[model samples]
Target chain A: MMTGAAAIAAGGAGSARQPRNAALPAVIFAIFALMPAFAALTAQHYLVDTGTRIIVYAVAAVALDLLVGYGGLISFGQAAFIGLGAYAVGILSAAGIGDALVSLPVAIAVSMAFAWITGVVCIRTKGVYFIMITLAFGQMVYFLATSLAPYGGDNGLTIDARNTIAGWPVLKNDTAFYYFAFLCLLATYLLCRALIASRFGRVLRGTKENATRMAAIGFTVQRFQLIAYVIAGGIGGVSGFLLANSTEFVAPAYMAWQQSGELIVMVILGGVGTLDGAIVGSAVYLLAEEWLSGLTENWQVIFGPFLVLVVLFARGGLIGFCARLRLRHG
Target chain B: MTATLFFVQVLNGLQLGVLLFLIAAGLTLVFGVMDFINLAHGVQYMLGAYLAVAFYGVVGNFLFALIMALLASLAFGLLLEFLVFRHLYERDHLDQVIATFGIILFLNHAVRMVWGAAPLTLPMPDAFTGSVLLAPGQLYPVWRLVIIASGIAVAGGLYLLVTHTRIGMLVRAGATNARMVSALGVNIKRLFMIVFGFGTMLAGFAGVMIAPIISVEPGMGTNILILAFVVIVIGGIGSIRGAFVAALLIGLVDTLGRSFSIDVLRLVMAPSPARTVGPAIASILIYVLMAIVLFLRPAGLFPARGR
Candidate 1:
């Protein structure tokens, strides 16, 4: 599968020397499979919990990269769908359906519906106009959350308990939930890798390079892009579900434009379009944020300038920078 | 509400519009001339307020503090343009957007670190302390009236500079086509800096003036920045006249909607329901207006070019 995907990626490569890429799913699964024993050896509950959160975000970040990196759609409202997913679980639990099976589908359905509605208008514009429109839509949802009187409004809604699966009591334990999240992350990575390597993914990548050329080739560009948008939104919803469950709280702030911005930063910081890069990026970003905030409440004062430097000086993000160093040494 | 209250709100709206116009002027000019979509422009406004507070602390005189603050803001804008923004001109809009957004994050938080997240206030000068009767029974703040007057004065000055002066003609040319202006031997880099710096100062001045009334705090400019974008979009990007008209229009609609939306709704519905729904709908009015304007005129109301 790795060789096959690499061959497909090579078909588009103009350069003679194709970059040696490792298969990401196998790498991630092997590490996560070892996570439990490692946690046991280390006696660290914090590691397991933090690791679970990172995997959740990694899933969402990869989904976001598919749209932003490959489809040329820069959405600053990805969190809107993530929050939608989380709220799906919370709202359902409140109404007496606390099963993960029911809540997950509800989350996916809600996210798809949101993507369809927002993507319709958003897809019409390109460039800066596109950015602002998506942002406004995100704000509209944020306001909707704030206005929701029954589900806690600005204060936020708290879950009654962690979601259960078929009366197994699997997710009641932190270690079990950690593995559950890890499994979801692994599934998402494989699904995304397959999607990006599929024939449809080729068309999407071509459209990103030059939409006019792709359209001229008889592709229904908007439909393809919209489909991609829905997929990303659905995946983002999964992360939101994980987040809501992890914290057992859902708030409008979770879907704020700023959160969307941070998600974008995470995607770019990792290496936009690289599946493994998303995981690495989310880990780096979340950890940096956690450590920095602990160090100083004004962590953003330092983080902000760091981002500017990354944008101004660095190209292709942390992954790209590492790849460059490898070439220089190798 | 009394006639005077209505009149005062109208005056208040105009004053707000004036401040918006000041910020929008530079934004329009930068967009028109440089074709740069700057997310960091709001930080310039935030910096202006912060600078004014700092200057007031140092000078202890309102007028001198404002003058020095404006200059400081202008200098900072020029410095940023020189250092960071100039590199972005040849890049894609996505890269520019990302870079500027980074600046916004840095500056908003930087201000918080410096100002301690607590809202600061600028003292109103002794001369403009009292209210004057606007209509038979309505007393309005004299300081607000000064704001309206000064805003108009600055607008007039900007108009003259852009239209009648040599540099202004060059700026007009630059707005239409930066390449053509450069081809004509104008120092385009200098012009960009001057335009950006001036725009930055105007945003800052608007911030300084409003700092007396509104709380000077971090993230204050974020909401206003979005509102300014709406104004410029409606007014047509790159057109100062359009910004002025659109700013006033937004000011009136927003202020009036906030004031009478409930009453207007009450006329047709139950008072209790109207009271609850009116404010929510009122808050959404400008965004709805923006969506409508975008639908009708995608480029904007007064697009710089006919296209």
Candidate 2:
């Protein structure tokens, strides 16, 4: 799994040379896995809840990183998939269908369908055009969600209960739900890791570097990008499913362009091209948000400048910044 | 009644187009000249409205408040450019987007802190408070006409500035090839600041103009910002003419779509379903148009850059 060729293909070689880089992901996961115990010791249920939220966002951010960081597709509409996933569960639950098996697949299928259609139009344009088109599609989804009056519309819909695995409320327990979200995050991270190392991933990366060259090499770049977009949208649906179950609510706000922007910010904050960076970035961002909002109603004033500083100073985000430190010391 | 509604909506659409052009002109110029994406541009518009409110409190004259707000908005925009944006011109688009987004977040919250969350209003100038009859039983606001006129004036002024002036030639050249313009010994930095300041003032002017009609509030710029983005994208990123055409096109389409979508939908579907689906379709109409445009002309109707 740690072969030289695979590492290079994964864009991991530069970071792989740094010894601390090898252990960072394992350390991050260990921290997450033990977070339940830490929460129990402190008797802070809020920690577990917030932790669950962070992990769920990490899942979306990782999926986003696949398209944005790896494929150079700065999709400003990833939240639409997340919204679709939540709405799938919300709509199904409203109809008295609470089975995870049924709703989760429906969510993914719906999101993929959306991604397929929108990605086709979006991938036709590049640079700023790509960003705006994705945003438009996202807005379209948001407006559609708000118009869904029967399913609660702009006010949002609350689920009576979480999705049951084969009619068993296994996720009813907080720790169980936390581990479930953790597992989902781990699976998504590994899947992205594997995807980026495959031949398909190489072609995607090649296109990001130079689409014309990729086309010259006989890869229909748009087809590959569209496939990547659909894959990301499906994974985003997973996060949305988890989110709806975790919070037991879904609203048009979930799919707003702001949410999509936050997802992109998470990827950038973590380090755009690094898979582990996405997870770390999501954790840092959400935790800071929770902490800041607790401190002041005007938390964005602080958070906004923080983001500007990050962009100005922290070139590669937390992960990149850390790697740079290692290079300097070593 | 139908004809009256149609006439009123067209005027409303044109009014909306004029406002959008004011914002989009600056946005397109900044994008064209510097290749910088400023998500906070909408905040400048919001700031303009807010400034007009505060200045009105001090100056006690609408015209004076308007001038003061424009100057303040220009200064504030230039300050931001000098402090934050100037550093980001050479960075990735994502970085520019994120950094500017941060500015938006900061300012929106900061404005909320200063002014409170409640939406404030600017009084319509006394000179233009009255309505004029277009026909029998059809009247339109004079202030709106003033907006349309002022927008046309600004567009005309910008056309002269960009096409006939030396600075305008440099801006056009920079949009087409910044590196070449820089190599030719033009002070690209000064040019960026000038372009940025002018664009900011345009957005602010739009804000002040519309403030009397709409509520002045923090985050009011967000939706308009999205609409402005839609304008520039459809207009082609760097072309002022494209922005003007696309802005009006969008304005008419959106206004007409929202007003008539239900009527059109009723022709094809049952009334209840039509009522429910109408607003949703209307809201998405511009995006659908954008998709079609991108599908047909990937670059836009009037791309400034050479393909």
Candidate 3:
């Protein structure tokens, strides 16, 4: 019904969206690949840290875009999946299992298991109910994390060390960890783009537009969404794994509803439905947090109204705005 | 737990229930009638308490402070409606969520700016002070009973207003289908304003009433706001009756669960495991209940007529 400005935001390679801006992803990834080198030259090691954080969150953002943008499944519980992922790493590391081989699979499997179970329930509800239920589930997961006193509970758990890659301490190096994160982001972006281009993706997108029609066409709408949800959750787990390793800590706060909200903000900030938008949105949001908070302690006071102004005027987010500008200039 | 102790817990649950209902009533109506998701509604609640504290300082009268605080809350709600929410009625739910989330951020911090980051307090009136002996050793506070009675009165008054009034009829019809009512020559915008303002006042009222019992602090409403959402969802989006039932149910379950989860777990499990698992289960008990309810009744307990 709302096939107006919002539908435009729900863009793909070939739909009602603007011309395929393939160069955008290339530019973004190239920038990501070179950031560490730039940091080396500039002697801003913190820039590497910021870049790694951006990459880790970008993976989750890409996953979130798959649901909120492509599928019209807005799960407010994205942070829960991330939390589950992070905690998997934290718990394993605390148990003296610091290898990625064990921790990585454990993280993805745990979050996917959580995703599958919750998605079974979450996919049944539609629209606002979906949002609320996901939120409720996210809160449940957050509370569980807070209650785990053995693994540090509310205080969160600090890893003894960064994860080793197959008996080698590759990720122990800051530069290597940054590259690992960048690789994860790259892989996630490509994987999602491939998925979206498949027939399954088309069916998922179809359900978003009109579920009744898709049902009539003999597609199991719920199955497609549930798979997408689980996939998104796995990606969230991967993000969580990196998040834990990068910081060498995991906390229940990582799964706070506010974190989920911020992830949504990242999705919308770049423009939803587009993987390119997801990455850009993550970089921009994290950068803003880094830059703005440095300006003053009360940066959100300014950020809050700025967000309002953005929603009021910037319909398609930063990426959409840029597209609009380019079109106007053309 | 002893019978008297259980009874005390039930009363406490009732107190929580009525407080939740007061917040949920406004929240459910706005959501039902307007289909707006105002995350900032919690801050409006916080605003109510803060305003009451500020007014009490000036007026030095609890009743007068409550009245002034309510009026101020209504005014502020209308202002927010005019400035922000009025434009968002046509947008989808995601946009509504983001915009309101921004308001929550602004308001929570704005609150800190106005009142320092430290928690503030409002003294209870002398009239409601002291405890009444309900049994041989059970002494219940008078103020809690007052909160319970007042909450019941508000709920009853709300029920009457919604069932018997012209505005009530419009609201019910609007919840069923807003566009149809708008098309039928009713001023849906005005109806929205009334609902929003009234909802704001109800949240504020809850804030004012509970101020004496709980510390008034920044971001205090975030957690309770979540509970209110849980209430409205379980009760059904647009049904006041559902909200009442769900709120009280949640109040009881949550209160009782926290009080007895350890004991309940101890019966079937080892004491060490029970002690460790008890608080965790207690905290998530309401969510578990909500998940079960959603699985059973996706639309909620008493969804208003259409949606």
Candidate closest to the true structure, highest DockQ: 3
Compared with the true structure, the alpha-carbon lDDT of candidate 2 equals: 0.90
Best by lDDT: 2
CAPRI quality level assigned to candidate 2 from its DockQ score: medium
lDDT of 1 by residue, A3-22 (tens): 22322342332111335358
Candidate 2 at B161: error in angstroms?
0.9
Give candidate 1 misplaced runs (Cα > 4 Å). Answer: A1-20, A23-37, B1-4, B267-276
Clash counts for the predictions, in order: 0, 0, 0
iRMS per model in Å = 7.4, 6.5, 2.4
Give residue B16's error in model 2 in angstroms: 0.5
Candidate 3, residues A214-320, lDDT tens digits: the string is 99999999999999999999999999999999999999999999999999988887877777878888888888878888996666787788778777887677777
Docking quality class, candidate 1: acceptable
Interface DockQ of candidate 2 = 0.53
| Each model's lDDT | 0.81, 0.90, 0.89
* Clash pairs (backbone) in predicted model 3: none
Q: Tell me the tens digit of each residue's lDDT in model 2 across B143-248.
A: 9999999999999999999999999999999888777899999999999999999999999999999999999999999999999999998999889999999999
Q: What share of the true interface contacts does each candidate keep?
A: 0.32, 0.69, 0.54
TM-score on 0 to 1 scale for chain A of candidate 1: 0.91
TM-score of chain A of each: 0.91, 0.93, 0.96
Candidate 2 deviant stretches above 4 angstroms: A1-20
- Sort by DockQ, best first: 3, 2, 1
- Residue-wise C-alpha lDDT for candidate 2, range A1-330, written one tens digit per residue: 012232243344222233346688899999999999998998897999999999999999999999988898889999999999999999999999999999999999999999998888899998889998999999999999988879887899999999999999999998899999999999998998889889999898888766888999899999999999999999999999999999999999999999999999898888887788889989999999989999999999999999999888877777887777778898
